[model samples]
Target: MKARASPSIIRRSFILPVLLMLAFILPFMFLRVAYLVLESSTLCSSPLDCMRLRLFGGSDSSLIMKMERKVQSSRWRESIYWHLASHGVPKNLHCLHLKLAEEYAVNASARSSLPSPEYMSRLTDSSFDHVVLLTDNVLAASVVISSTVKNSGNPGKLVFHVVTDKKTYSPMHSWFAMNIVASAVVEVKGLHQYDWSHEVNIGVKEMLEIHRLIWSHKYKYMKGEDFEFLVDHERDLEFLSPRFISLLNHLRIYIPELFPDLNKIVFLDDDVVVQRDLSSLWHLDLNGKIVGAVVDSFCGDGCCPGRKYKDYFNFSDPVISADFRPDRCGWLYGMNVFDLEAWRKTNITRTYHRWLKFNLDSGLELWNPGTLPPALIAFDGLVHDIDPSWHVAGLGYRYPQVSLQTLKAAAVIHFSGPAKPWLEIGIPELRSLWTRHVNFSNKFFTKCRIEE
Candidate 1:
């Protein structure tokens, strides 16, 4: 070489190469550290092991082995997913959801016959007893109707007044149209069918805002925190489905406004699966009471406070606690007999509006921000407790603990919580109770590819 390369030149060349390598390698090294940190805390195991213990009739080791194999095959996949995706509603499965989009598209319009607009006026025209259901979930409503009719000894003696939101009117009407309940009359109407311009309900927007804001920060409104109380489910907000949080949940309050002619009607939640004949419910006299409901399994009043209604309101305020026994127990919502004719006479709806106005004006966090607290205040002494056998509450919230015996004995099972049978997180053992009612062959479920 021309008197060998100078030492400075050689050192400079080496340093340049080193810097280039560091630039390329540093990001990879950082990523590796992050991956290690995250993997340690990740929930890598599947529910298969739990399912095995719950129902598989197989060995735990075999389940573990199956899990190990699954993890191994998807070893590289985890790295991609861990960096990119969420836990529930896996992206891989979402690819199959095209059918849902297709089914909900414009093609899915009403195919069945609906009653005349004046059907409500001719209350005595139908031979069947009437049951009213209000919800936005077309699928769940379909299940309820199908199951109710299937169990009803007299299908011809059943009339269903299905009320839904504007967007859902098509699907709701469509399903009932294609799948007629034999001789039973199925009526589908949108929430807009009712007039809300009345003076009593004109402030609905403000009332909803008040309920919405305070109810969200329930703990802050609870005054203070207790360690023991906080740790032991006292602060447990409980999971509520988005569907249950809407104005629709509060729609029960407007039954008289929605159906003017019906004297009494059985109200069923969309999540309820009717097993026994609900026609008998129409026969049960509400005894002139405005509402007939089962005891709220989880809420109560202040003076007798345990849980339930008391927990939902800020009883600390004299406005809420005064004469409104925080200790007075409340009732459940799922299956109820609403005497609209009777409710129309009382100031119950007016009282409901008054409280809603109070809660809004003072920002008092009055009753829990939901439909129930207002009902509790409005129907304080008007509710009549029916046989607990008619309704079973809390299936969706407290899953595994719910015994098969209770489910089997109940006339109606209500999944009030977020873990509905149709969702991915639904309890396997309990989902079958709902799925059995779903006609898998139905074009909607088949087109949407909804499987057990």
Candidate 2:
């Protein structure tokens, strides 16, 4: 221990420790260098700022702030993209329509798909369980018919009245004609087939212009605080989407006039799939209430947070505030059981027309776009709260929040939100439930590249 070590031995001993230290420090140094290189593009706005950031590592919250901005921008872009997609028909479905139209034009059997006179008579007989569906989609109509008939206890009693626009008439009729539902009677009628007054047409046209203006320039009407609600407002606007402003969407108000012989009917949106026997809905006593529907209050989840009257109507308007309570809860419309007999006694249609004119005259300030707002006003006291299990809605936007138990127990599941099941943007899990009812193996579907 007293002996002095040689210079070479001492140097070797020091070198080993130094090498270990360098090895440990190198990784951290490399990581820092990589971070700087990766973030070079956004290191700082100016040369001085970059130098200061590198030297002091101060005011570096800018990086995190920039990241946050990017995230927000991404979300906004996503919302806009979804809105655009929802408003248009999917390419595959458009292809299906074209192929079906071609088939209808040439194939004799395609034109003869309507049920015989004996079964066709049952449409107006009203003894059968009548379900009304208004849509221009051929695939959707097929799914609705297929699912309802498949789930019905008495399939023979189920009759579907499918209404479509003029453009979709040929394809819609051909589809039902070629692929007939054995148990159910499907009657496809076009808008042109219906006989209504020119006065009614003018009223709808005026409403259209008002709605178009409101939707086309939605942000123009927003107040300072309202911008905070832009996220929810965008979602609400889907209900009144431009895609749904067609004449068919307005036809719900005139249900009594449309089907005079039917005492009652189950109105189904094309976006819904029936999971249980709907015959029971026909038997439910509405107790003088014009419509039997599931209340949004019972949702108990995000799928359908209870909406109030104020959520739909403009309470700032004197007429709206005087007549409607801001806190009054709203019911859903997708799977409603309407007592047409009761509706006929009331001036509901006239009231609807009056409000439509009033809203147009007031410069579209009364409510948001879409048919639901006017409907909520028109059917104010006439909604009968049916069992929540009968109709489970919000499949389009909030499918994840809905539990398996609830969905399994539901008689009808509605994709009330913008993401309709047939669309590419539709959630995969929920889409499967709707697609299960679709006949993917059908020749027409295969020919048109329509797949699961």
Candidate 3:
């Protein structure tokens, strides 16, 4: 200061420290940006997770985790509500229900005598072809029966056993009674008609309660947690939604007990349309396996590339982790051949009930809330893989990237996802496959305004 330092000396003194500071900070900043870029590409597939890293600072790990959990919780809640609202009984179905109900009130003969003594006796006959369909949706059930009858090699031999809830019993009965398929015997029965044991009734009640708790996010209360979990493990809970869970889904687990007189039966979900003759399934030897189904994918046995046991089970628990492998393959439920004889011989039904009880005891942590997961565990190693061509699934969600030749060749096309062919959200391109089976000219369709 006394010497009055030169201007160049003062400038160099100030610039050197500033340059050093930028050099030190630049590397760390570059490293952080690279880390975020890599994470965004690989780990942050969820849009919400990606947004958080950009908008919210990442210095506080606890705060970041909390924000992520909150966002995921909100998303899950929104999804559950949307699914519930979208899947409610559609307007056309309600209109048909009302029209049928009114018809029943006016015409006593509208309820035709279904399953006369001859067909009633055939219900337990092992010689005839038996197809069991359980559903409450009248239009869907009609499509299944109509398509199946239309595609059968011997329609006279086909006998359909349709089971429905009491509320839809009259409408379902009326539909089958009024519109008789070509030579195919249709027997419609309400769930109340069957005599369920105390344990069976209790199991259904418990499973339904668990399904409700899961979709509503109240499962945390059942799990002893005061708040929703940080993870969205219930993403697949839609498969167990009200549309899927109803008495029909639960009834599949007890097929052996439900139809004790039958030897083998082809179980069809209402969402499927028969494109070709399914009579061959009756003759195919199950190789002594209880459940004969097409593996969900074409992947080799025990080597499905997409979903596996780990997807359906909570492997973190010691019991599940010890008992099952995560890589085991999963199969579909929409179209399956159940060998009731072999099923009864083994403890499959008992095993199913045991697992259901165990899942309930574990606060529903053993598996998700659909019959498929427990059925996977109960029927482990007991599934006989059928030809993939017999059943082609996943037609309901979006336009599947399948060839027209493949669709034409598939014996049964299943609209198994949420976007049912009857729903407005159904994929337009695929909806035709199902709607073509509907007789739009029928008086019922005209009355209910059911058109493609």
Candidate 4:
């Protein structure tokens, strides 16, 4: 107290403490600034609600968790399936495995077996009564074409325009060329030969080709407990099939564009078998409508057009909600009679494009799976209801529950849902109907392991 400290010493002491405090505070301040800058730069790729929750939001977001779990589940299931299939634990390899398309082309016997694809170009002339079948499933195509022609009372009148993608063109052509259906003229053409679908249209095909690719956060329309429910649920069992079967399955949508010169044609799906004359379908009057299709199923009163197509789309968007009614009855797509002249008059293609584009831009808010919903919308007012007996659906999903009487009565039976008659999953008893059409005696059949 008696001796006062020097000014330099006092100043030195104060400076030391201040410097120490800054040293401790500066690092923390820098760390906080860095964190804020990093956070502000974070951007979400998709506008989906899940993206927002995952990016800037909370871990408690049930939607995010559900998506994660669902993805994990699919991966898990796929791995288990692969493991079993690799070990030959699977009873039917058809469902579990797929041979490379080139493999079919490689077999000498298979290549030698098909009928000439030379008649493929004749579709443009409209001189013949054509039954158009567009597919890449050579096996299924063979069965369907053979069955259709075999069941027809007049096989010579039947002309099958089997259109496929470029990669499949040669093999498909070969298959048909070798296994010539008696009196039925079969034509095979690649997608490249058809100049109808534009570049943008090709993109649609590509998108479908890659749909199973990282579903990820692209589709995030759900929230809360509902998200959890969808984790285990496959909305439509057919949703997964399109990824592998994209090229063939979606070709049905562009039938009018594919065959520009044809006025009227009968379109058959690859999964279908004809037990009666489909020529009768061509004879039925469409009443000026562009499409003739059978109703999917009867409703409470057993009326036609019972299935509501609108249910497949997301009506939450103002664009979709304003344009479509969720209660409208939907039609099926297996065997359709397309009136090309009438179709050209309508904006079915344009409508299909517009809706398809909107759905693409809107993150596929239209249909959850497959190409049917777009066709349903595109052919909305243009569908003519044929007799229900002409096409029998639900054979795939519920074969046992199907009335044997009804199945027998059907002119055409569609393995519409998923359990295709050719797959191991198909009902053995029901499969005999489709198997009868396969040429097991053909060398291609034995070489390709296309077992009966």
Candidate 5:
């Protein structure tokens, strides 16, 4: 101070402080910039409202590219350009894998590879707000995807892109435009693998597949979740009465306890339709029973060992010999209502597993392990018997001589014989019913039904 500080010393002190600050801040700035670039490049948003759009489902590189091109095209440009410019989507949307960890045979594999809540948190930290699951594997993928989509619906928007395999292209054509309006398209290579090993009987692999579908969809309800499990046999299902929707809604309110926190399902066989509102069936009480089935007297007597008169209901009825009085428990055959929780609690899977083991051990061949009489007798609880007013059960049109009065009263007619209405013979009433339900003009829906 006494010598008067040199200008060089003052300048050196200021420069040194400035350099130290820059060194500390520069790396952080660089890192932030890198993160921004990566997010912007990878994220994508819809052309329309960013709040409404979500991308999800199983997709390959080709399908993804195609979707990207579509979004970039002039048709979608106005709706999407701003989003693209802002790098809005990838930054705001989360991608979820539909594949299950257990199926892949790896420990914590789903946690490590598939997107979890934690992954979603980290992604959202950067800006992502929505989740979409893409998948070709229907059962595994859809189950997982639906769970995530529903759960994430509150915190962020959720969507599912059900990219059917190439073989199913024609079947989904009519719905394509509608699909595009809602979500992007993904073309998968093939349908999920179908397992035939656990089939109940020879040539009933299709039936076994249907059973699998029932279990897969109902598991959520059994686990006490609110979900609408629509168990359509296939896309070919045509509802004769448009009023079916109202019927389902009525069932939800009036018979709430029947299904227990799940959407009451309508299990339609291919050959039936409703001419009037089905609300009556939905409101019908099942007491505490878990399932409802149409009573059929013609169930193959020889098929059920328990159906024989020797297995009489009252073993001690001295006046009624075992050979004279059979346990007429009224079998729940064809078109049935399943109480998801009740069925789960009964351990149907374990029962089915035990049945399979018994059959294998005894070298017995049984077709349709779900043959109602046996299942009803074997199951722990009672099943409610619905009037034939809802279900007309028989060989489809083969019994043309049978009364249509029965058919008219029936909410559902089961074509349970060799000749199907689609074959143009069995039940003329059924053919008429099918025609009434389906619009022949829609080639896509028609084709899907035939293929299925």
Candidate 6:
């Protein structure tokens, strides 16, 4: 500096430093490029390899096999028998509850139906392997027991279960069952309990309670069990197929894992009945995918009605940075499956809870317990679209014949529409289907008698 270095010397000095920096960076850059190329080659070798990487974290053969085993041993494979009955079994109420019970048995061979009268003594004896009691408007513990006995061919391995609230049972009966039978009654007390603050919130409360019942059943009965598959049905369901047992068995053997992460579950709503054996749908390979939903509108141009609702909630789209798109397909609308393990591990439940809190805190009313948030959270970038035949909304407007034709092509039929067969505005087509498949005359009257 004192000598006022010559221009050439200064330039040379700067050039030397620049060259040295490049020399260091060039090697790192080369290594990065080489690694990327190697990784790309390894990952792109085959479809299975690529899928493995995307699903189980890598293309390592051992890892894939381990993941497959985990899937095979998943809790979703375990047999889940569901009963959705209310408090009082009315004679006229046989329409929905009895139909659902028959459908449940048709779906799962392992599942047995014990109506209330039969359930009382069986609960104390523990005669059945797995028992599910639907308690709502019915107080017929005897009917539940009898239904299970009648539906279940074997009862020695019985696991007594009940889904209801304290209101569903008389105080004396609740105390009696609790003290004598050692029965497990799952009631959603926290967020699921009935609240009369607002009428609009009632639907949300009911949906939440249903979800809670599913979760509680999972934790209590299916946590570590290894079995074929778990199925839940509402009291309003009808069975149109006789191959329900075979289909469930096929799913258990072929896929071996229904919900790998416990983050997902396939929910078949009761309104729809089966036309074909659902084995094909059960065998669908999720390839570690988190959610699979039947495409509601095949038109493909239709949009989700809930898109604008996202803005109202101040929520950001996790998939697209922009506002939530109504056209996005994986909304878990009618019948959906969940990956239970993944769900438990991720913020799914937390997200749902937060969303609920946000809605309640902001004094915003909601319907259906909000299926979108958990759907968004569990969507790991892939959602398989099943056939439309799987879910034909059974609103009376759609002719039952057309719906049945659709059902014939589908693995499962979801009665997602408003008009139910039990309701007055019945679809003559469904009634015809029921007459053809189920012994409606005998079973229908029997159900009525049992309920009465």
CA deviation > 4 Å runs, candidate 6: 1-91, 94-265, 300-322, 329-334, 365-382, 394-405, 434-437, 443-452
Better of 3 and 4 by lDDT: 3
lDDT of 5 by residue, 1-452 (tens): 47978999999999999999999999997886565454434333332222112223424455456445544453333423322232221211111111121223343332232223334333223122222222222222322332232233232422222333433322222232222222212222122322223432342333344333333333333347422322321111111112122222112212222223343333333233434434344445777776676544422433331134333233354433332335454453445565554554565544544544443343322212233322544443556767646665553423343465655665555555434444423345455554443334443334334311
Give the least accurate 10-residue stretch of model 3, judged by summed lDDT. 214-223
lDDT winner between candidates 3 and 6:
3
Model 5 steric clash total: 20
Model 4 lDDT per residue over 1-452, tens place: 59999999999999999999999999997886555555434322233544455446656557556556656666655543532332222333232123434545575654552334565455455656788887767788888888887778888778888888886776676666555678877777787876654774775665454343313212233212243333354333234343333656666656666777788898888888989987777777999888888764533343433256454666777876887877765777777888887887888767876766667667665566556777777887788888777887766653344667878888888876556776666767788888998777665566556677
TM-score, candidate 4, is 0.68
1-452: candidate 1 lDDT, tens digit per residue: 47998999999999999999999999997886556445433323544344444344546676556545555545534433432221244332242234333344545344434774545544544345878888777678878988888888888778889888876676666666556677667888887766766763655565566556655655464436333222243223441223325777667777877777677788999889988987767677777778888864422233121135566777888877776766566688878988777888999988987877777677655665467777788898898878767787666643344567767888888876646777766667788989898877765566556776
Candidate 1 vs 2: which has more TM-score = 2
lDDT of each: 0.67, 0.79, 0.78, 0.66, 0.37, 0.39
After the best TM-score superposition of candidate 1, give how far the Cα of residue 171 lies from its true spot, in angstroms.
1.6
Q: Candidate 6, after superposition: displacement of residue 398 in Å?
A: 6.6
User: Cα deviation in Å at residue 81, candidate 3?
Assistant: 7.1
lDDT of 6 by residue, 282-356 (tens): 345666654556544533365431223342223443433354554354443444443444444454434444554
Error of 2 at 407 (Å): 1.2
Q: Please name the candidate that would achieve the greatest lDDT relative to the true structure.
A: 2
